[model samples]
Target: MKRGVRESIAVSAVLLAALFILPLLVIVPFRSELLTREPPMDETEGEPFVSGDLDSRTVLKVKNGDTVEEMDLGTYLVGVVRAEMPASFAEEALRAQAVAARTYTIYKLQTGGNHGSEADICTDSTCCQAYISEERARANWRKNANDYEKKVENAVTATDGETILYGGVPILAVFHSSSAGLTRAAGQVWLNDLPYLQAVDSPEEGDTIPNYYSRAEFTAAEFKEKMLAAFPEADFSGPVDRWLKNAVTDSAGSVETVEVGGVTVKGTQVRAALALRSACFEWEVQGEKLVFYVTGYGHGVGLSQYGANQMAADGADYKEILTHYYTGVTVEPYSFALPG
Candidate 1:
């Protein structure tokens, strides 16, 4: 059977959305196809294709509609999938559609403007990459986007009610997507009352942290000396040498909670502050400066899409891809389909 694709226009900026994946609690069974083989594409259906030339819509300037709308790049991406992708990607698309359907369903039932319009979708920094040349996105489009549309369309059509209850309240529906560009390693999904439902570069991609692009290099000694320089009167131990030997440790107890300028903070945060203070004395070679350069983007707790793509490219099936990061979760039919 063929499935349909669904999409929503995003109004928010993409960079603003650091983390879009919502955490799990809903018992929706992940279809094996969601993490397995994608459904077959229907060559017969006449779907629109993006040629190497310019897309007409891209040139359309933003104008004020009857009601202003705002959305994240994630929502726009989902819309692109629905408008351009195929059923193969649609029926089994992961992450994006799940969030989008939930968001759309929520919004359909809610009134007022608790959520912004689709004008706010941003596509800057790590939040989103420039649209790939048609040549590059084609392969990707074939493998992933097409099928995702089907899945979203199905979910949207299948909703028994117009709105979904998230965190106990009904809100508008809008999905989000991204490389998770830059942020601390905690996955939160409040844009629509969801958490890391679609995290890419999750922890299962092995021990290597997905560096935004290197490593944290500030020496503990250098960090401490800078801290001492910042707070000369505070009773800090001996020179940088002594502090390096016993200051910071992975152990929770090693963290000393202290009040600084009327604000109490954890040892790690304090250590981080010292590192930043020291960094000010260093050089800004490429982009961000850090004592320790962490790799990848987003929290390392769920699935890593980049890793999954690499795996997929290397011939790893979707199930293998899903299992590699999602820990232990079953992928079965939810018996739900989008209503016509």
Candidate 2:
């Protein structure tokens, strides 16, 4: 009750009040603003952004053609899963798509996006990832629209900020509609050989997948024209059957090196030039026409949508499905931070 004791009590009271009130004043405003501002990407350093302190509600700049739109990361992911994978797919498959799509978006944002300073990502499935408005997705779903919308929304919410990571880094997470029994390797499909994007066994096959097996027929003259368009130096003047020769196939039966008109060309190039469903194809002279018996769809790299659905049907969870297709990887809540 003396003067010194009263002064100590007064100091303690002030310290306690400051501890509780100071944090709210400092944190509340920054957290709210995090939803609208661009991710702090330091361009001069030429390094991926990394930050330990970040609000959970991340923002993304989406490039929809010429104009750019900004929205919550979760909202952006829901649109991507809705556009990239069918709502009819199993819930686990949808969840896998959600995580993969999120990783792709984050990776692009951190690793010098293709759009430069304009955007973090784009809506084009070919360039970035497909994204459609909820109204349009509902219109496409029709009768089961509400259920489908809820399913996609649930998938994104359930996975939240999860992402597929390889070596503690968010990967490219490239995916396709389907695969040719087995998914293709990164080096086989693209220039870089990512360790996690190697070829792996995929379960989706047969008639269950659309265009699992298809044929593209061209007359000898038509085949020559298409081949010449890509391989201008190649000679297609020979017996129709002989023109397509020396096809070196991968273990999955996808063409690795195929001799087109005696000129060795990559199977991927043939798929591009002929507009085939996939690189896993073989050509033969069926009567007067050159027929290419193609299998599966897309570039056959990374996650396979139909394949993921098949795995989900077999009782695998989202984590299991993603890891299976992506080789050595882990599914965990992503550290939504810009790499420094």
Most lDDT-accurate candidate: 2
Span of 10 residues, lowest total lDDT, candidate 1:
52-61
What are the clash counts of all predictions, listed in order?
71, 6
> Residue 327 lDDT in model 1?
32
lDDT of 2 at 230: 95
Clashing pairs in 2: 48-339, 49-338, 49-339, 50-338, 50-339, 50-340
All candidates' lDDT scores?
0.34, 0.85
Candidate 1 residues 139-167, lDDT tens each?
Answer: 55665544444453343333212222335
TM-score of 2: 0.80
lDDT of 2 by residue, 1-340 (tens): 6999999999999999999999989988898686688787433322221211222368777898788997778888878889999999999999999989888888888788888777778899778889998879878998777778878887887887788888888998999988878998999877889998988988985687777899899988888898899999998667787888898989888898889888998999999999999999987788779988998888989999999999999999999999998888998887685433
Q: List TM-scores for all candidates, in order.
A: 0.33, 0.80
The reply for model 2, stretches above 4 Å from the true place, is 1-56, 337-340
For candidate 1, what is the lDDT?
0.34
